[model samples]
Structure formats: structure tokens, C-alpha cells
Target: MAEDMNVSKGKLQRDLGLLDAVGIGVGAVIGAGIFVVTGVAAGVAGPAFLIGLLIAGFAATCNGLSLPN
Candidate 1:
């Protein structure tokens, strides 16, 4: 039954280390900062900022998709 299911019997490895954990935490903080800054920017710039934001998002999506997997 296990063979039919094709499940791996090998044990999973613990890969993440201290630096990886710290990097993840820093990324989360920066992500939150971006949101806060974006809100402030929208308030200051009004409707124009939203159009720029949409354009920036599309560019970012294109950049992300271009990266090698």
C-alpha cells in the first residue's frame, strides 16, 4: 500500500538555522513598514499615488515572473 502511494520513507531534515530565522523576522518587519509607508504615501499623494501603485505592482509582478525558478 505504501509503495502504491509512492510516499517517501526518508526522514525530513531540519534546514532552517539561526540566520535564516533572523532574516525571516527582518523581512516581516520590512513588509509591515512598506504597508505603513504606503498608507502615508496614499494619504499625501491622494488618487495619483494609487495609479502609481498599480503600475509599480505590475512591474514587480513582471520582474518576479522573469526570475529563474
Candidate 2:
């Protein structure tokens, strides 16, 4: 597979192990999305995204606290 050029620099800077390499790649994509997707997310999810995120976070916390990790 071809290396993702976007992740190469971060992986190099982090002295990435295999797991870190995977994390670097996901981080690179997520960072780009945050930079590029504001307009799209706002248009699609509208003013409710913040509230939705909070609700989801609360649900996640409740589930985590209740469950065996």
C-alpha cells in the first residue's frame, strides 16, 4: 500500500511505533476534517450539533460508568 503523504511527517516527528503510526494517520484525517468541514457540518447538522455532541458525550459517560471497561 502507498503511504499517506499527509501522515509521514507526523509519524516521523513522533518516532511512531506501528500503533502510533495508525494513530498519526487517523489524527491527520481528523485534523483536516475539522479544518475543512465546519461549513458542511453546520449546514448538515445545523445549530443542533453542539447540543447533540453534549448529549452523546453524556450518554457515553453514563454508559462507561455503568459498564465494565
Candidate 3:
């Protein structure tokens, strides 16, 4: 058991750099904002919120496709 634990610990590495950490933080904030906005939109729009969500998703898809490589 002790040898197995030592091997597991040695195999793990702290590999995240500054940019990776920043990207993760930004992604988390944006994800939280999306959840809050969805809740508020649902309360205000009721059943219509689903329709708006579909439209938003379609728009996002289009926007993503239009981005230059």
C-alpha cells in the first residue's frame, strides 16, 4: 500500500502555467454568469425563455463558424 501511494504521488505533476490558470478562472466566471443570466431570463420570459435560448444557441453557432482560423 505504501509503495503504491508513493508511485501515485510521483506520477502526479503541477503542470498548469499562468495562462492555463487564467483561462480556467475566466471560464469559471463566464460559466457562472451564464447560469445567473439563464435563471433571470427564465423568470422574466417563462415559456418563451426556451425559444430565446434556441435562438441564442443558433446565433452562437453561426458566430463560431464565422470566426477566422
Candidate 4:
């Protein structure tokens, strides 16, 4: 799946230390969003795809490390 990405997949699963269960969650997330959302964003937003990815990635980064209550 990650291999199919046009960009390099930098061992995010390994770094995340998620066992099979949560890894599946992450894959499901990326797969769903990357599949459905990317085309829409690219079409409507066009040249902002890269910039949008940067912003979305930053948001995702913050979300990832956030502590649970």
C-alpha cells in the first residue's frame, strides 16, 4: 500500500510502534483519505496539492502525538 505511494514511504509503521491492530487503523485512515480525498483536493485546489499536503501533514503530526484524556 505505502509502496504504491508516488512519494517515498519512510517506515512510518515501524516508527509508530503500533502492533497489527493499530497499524491496521493507520493504514485504513491513510488509505481512505489518500484514495478519496487527494483527487478532490488536487482537482479543486489544483496547484496547491503539495502545499495542502504539507499543511495536512502538519495537522496530522500534531494530532498523532496528542495525549488522550
1 or 2, which is superior by TM-score?
1
Q: Could you tell me which residue pairs clash in candidate 4?
A: none
Report how far off residue 54 is in candidate 1 (Å). Answer: 1.7
Query: Model 2, 1-69: lDDT tens per residue?
Result: 126544554355446599988999999999998867866876799889778778879999998889565
What's the candidate order when arranged by decreasing lDDT?
1, 3, 4, 2
Q: Give candidate 1's whole-model lDDT.
A: 0.90
| lDDT (10s digit) by residue, model 1, range 2-66 | 56656566744467999999999999999999999999999999999989999999999999889
lDDT by residue (14-54, candidate 4, tens digit) is 34454867989989999999778878878898888889799
Pairs of residues clashing in candidate 1: none
Query: Top TM-score: which candidate number?
Result: 3
Best by lDDT: 1
Candidate 4 residue 49 Cα shift, in angstroms, is: 2.2
Model 2 bad stretches (over 4 Å): 1-22, 34-39
User: What pairs collide in candidate 3?
Assistant: none
Model 1 clashing-pair count: 0
